[model samples]
Target: MYKYDQYDQALVDARVDEFRDQVARRLAGEITEDQFKPLRLMNGLYLQLHAYMLRVAIPYGTLSSPQLRMLAHISRKYDRDYAHFTTRQNIQYNWIKLEQAPDLMADLASVEMHAIQTSGNCIRNISSDQFAGAAADEVADPRPYAELLRQWSSFHPEFSFLPRKFKIAVTASDTDRAAIQLHDIGLQLVRKDGQLGFRVLVGGGMGRTPMIGHWVREFIPVSQYLTYCEAILRVYNRYGRRDNIYKARIKILVHELGAEEFTRQVEAEFAAMSDLGLDAPQAEVDRIAAQFADPEYDAGAPDTLDRSDPDFAVWVDQNVHAHKHAGYAIATISLKPPRGIPGDASSAQMDLIADLAERYSFGELRVTHSQNLVLAHVRKADLYALWQALAEADLATPNLDLVTDIIACPGLDYCTLANARSIPVAQKIAARFESDLARQRDIGELKIKVSGCINACGHHHAGHIGILGVDRKGEESYQLSLGGSGAEDASLAKILGPGFNKAGVVDAVEKIIERYRSVRSGPDERFLDTYRRLGDAPFKEAVYG
Candidate 1:
């Protein structure tokens, strides 16, 4: 995990002081609600339907045990006793008081975390593969570059206010766990001919309009990526639409100006940037990289796991992933419990995770984009003990990529932008399938994502089965889409016909699962595979009929 240096600490402290004044002004009636809106938003504070929501950034989803414990304390002390982990790998506290927000910000600053850029038009928290450092097949750890970008983008003068919010993600793996293709800028760290660089993609995003980013540059050397990023943003700032909020995103601009033309303009901009010296010197990136160095591993640590216990074995099989080290495994803690809220972790749960991270993972954990937590370096020999601890707290649910592990956003229940409630539908689907554990397991590697609206906060556009809540006249209606994925093979899901009522949505999902089971070549063929092979016709017919 990257620790904040003096500069980082000073910047955050200054922000806290500045925000404290802002909050005081608002509370003292020196600034009205209208005046405080942008100020609050810039600090990652949102006035929700019921209360203020504070989104705290967990940079690239990496957290120290102390940071995790602080988050737990915040949830327990200030708001409700839980927090929601988001698709962007950030955490949200839904019941915040405006007056106490500055105190919360100060508390976060104490732990070297903040809500800065988690919201607003500036570059959001730079995200990457949660398995970045541990994944077996990755070319290199991507978080170093992600952290570099984070440092570069934080309060960047030129990009402080873009036409729309921007997102950037990095990954070094062929498996694409970070969903880079759906970001505003996706960087695939690559090494070619002994030179390390990135295969860059731009313009990908999801909202009302979902898009897979187009290839902007085949390669940008690591030494020049920052300059290239500046060039891309400069091109976007110059021509991206400002009149219509809907057309303000760079993705919309890229679509309007053809990808080839956009690339040409960016290249021209890049050529002009060499004289500006925008690229960081090698030493700076080296400094950041050193912070992400691998933890100490016992060379003689046991590689074997005793899976004699079927229940423990099931968890190990489902949640544990291959680590780069032979003796260590990456264990995913499923936040999706039976019929429970998808991403909400109680304070106790957070504390337990922190303790587990300390005991089994060098005091560190990674938050997956799918709303799960990962103990990235757990020893294989301690698997059973870890499983037992997690199970006791109801954290060990053996559904990693299964149908029951649903991803859902804070829909109408919390988000003011939502037309429908997303939590109930997710709960319904999980509960429905969890009834028959074997049947659920039979429908393997299925991802069900639900969003309260078209904002796609839950990444509905990237699910094997996607559900979007919409306002139908005056009632909540759920729309379904099938065959989308956020993995290496990225594609937007296609809608399956008419919207359904809450009850009907579960039935519709059940019908699709049955259709996939009936049509798949074998159990190895996933729900996504079945949908892609056969298309939506069979699933659509099964649902609408």
Candidate 2:
């Protein structure tokens, strides 16, 4: 977790003060709704269909136990008792009062958190792999880079107002847990010639037009990260479509200009900025890296891998991920309870996670890109005890990367742009496959993502099974997609024929899963492998024909 320095503290404090006055003016009728719209959005406040929604940034999805406790306190003190975790790795309070927003911002600032760049058409939160430091496959932790970008982009005069909301993601593993390919700018940290660098992907986004990003630069040395990033944004800001909000994302720019031409433009900018000394000093980089140093571990500790508890073993197999440390495991706290709202955590649950992170883990928590919480540095020996504690807290669901662990957005509940309710659909899917042991073994690896609209906030286009909600007249309908994946082998999901009505959509999903179960070579083979082997003919037949 990156601690706030004086510069960071001052920035947040100033934003809070600015927003405080803005709130007062709005309340006193000094500004009209139209006038207040951009101001509130810049502060991450949205006037939803029912009430004002405040999205607080978790910055690369990292949170301290104290910060988590503050979130719980805020949720309990203001708004509703629960907060929805978004795909951007943020938490949104859906029922915030307009009058209390300034106070809430001040409270968040007290915890070294804020809603800056959480909304509006500017550089939003820079996200990365939630399991960054703890994932065994990672070459390097991506959070420091994410934190660096956050510092560079937050309130940056050059990028304060862009054509559209921009998102950046970084990862350091072969597995694309951060869904980097779907972001505006995605960075995969890699090692080349015994030095760290990044594989940069740009112009990748989801919305009405969903396209997996194209590689803009390969092996960009880490020393020039901010320079190259600025180059990309500068090009986009200069030429990206702004006449229509629909065509404003960098993805659209990539589409119109083509990857080759876009690469040329970005390269030109990079060349011009090279001598400008845009790279942070080595000392600053070390400072950020030091903030992510590994915690002390007891060297001669007994391995906790031989635990006899079946549930604990199941959880370890499903929920626990490989850690960089020998004795540690990254524990994923699944928010997917049986029939519960996906990614929605009550304030009490949030506090419990905060406590567990402090006691069992390393006083650090991460909000995964999959919309789950993570206790990133739990010792393997303590996993069973952690599981017991989490089970009591209803956070011990063993459905990580499984069909039951569905990734969904807030859909119709809070999103005015949503066509249908997504939470209910996600709940129905999870409830349909509620067996723990059965799912742990049977489900294998599957990514099922659903979104309320074509905006693709839930990243439906990247799921093995993607569901998109559409409004046909007054009724809600859904379209199913097949073969989509957000990994090293990234590909956009293809739509499977006509859309289904609300009731029919669940049955459609059930039918697809049933077909997968029957046609799979063995239980160990994932749905994706089977789908790749057998193609969509069998699925289409079982689903539609």
Instruction: Tell me how candidate 2 scores on lDDT.
Output: 0.89
Instruction: Give per-residue CA lDDT, model 2, range 115-137, as digits (tens).
Output: 99899889998888988888888
Query: Could you give me the TM-score of model 2 versus the true structure?
Result: 0.98
lDDT of 2 at 333: 92
> Model 1 segments beyond 4 Å from truth?
none
Name the candidate that leads on lDDT: 1
What's the lDDT for residue 393 in model 1? 94
Residue 55 accuracy (lDDT) in model 2: 95
lDDT score for residue 288 of model 1: 84
Clashes of 2: 0
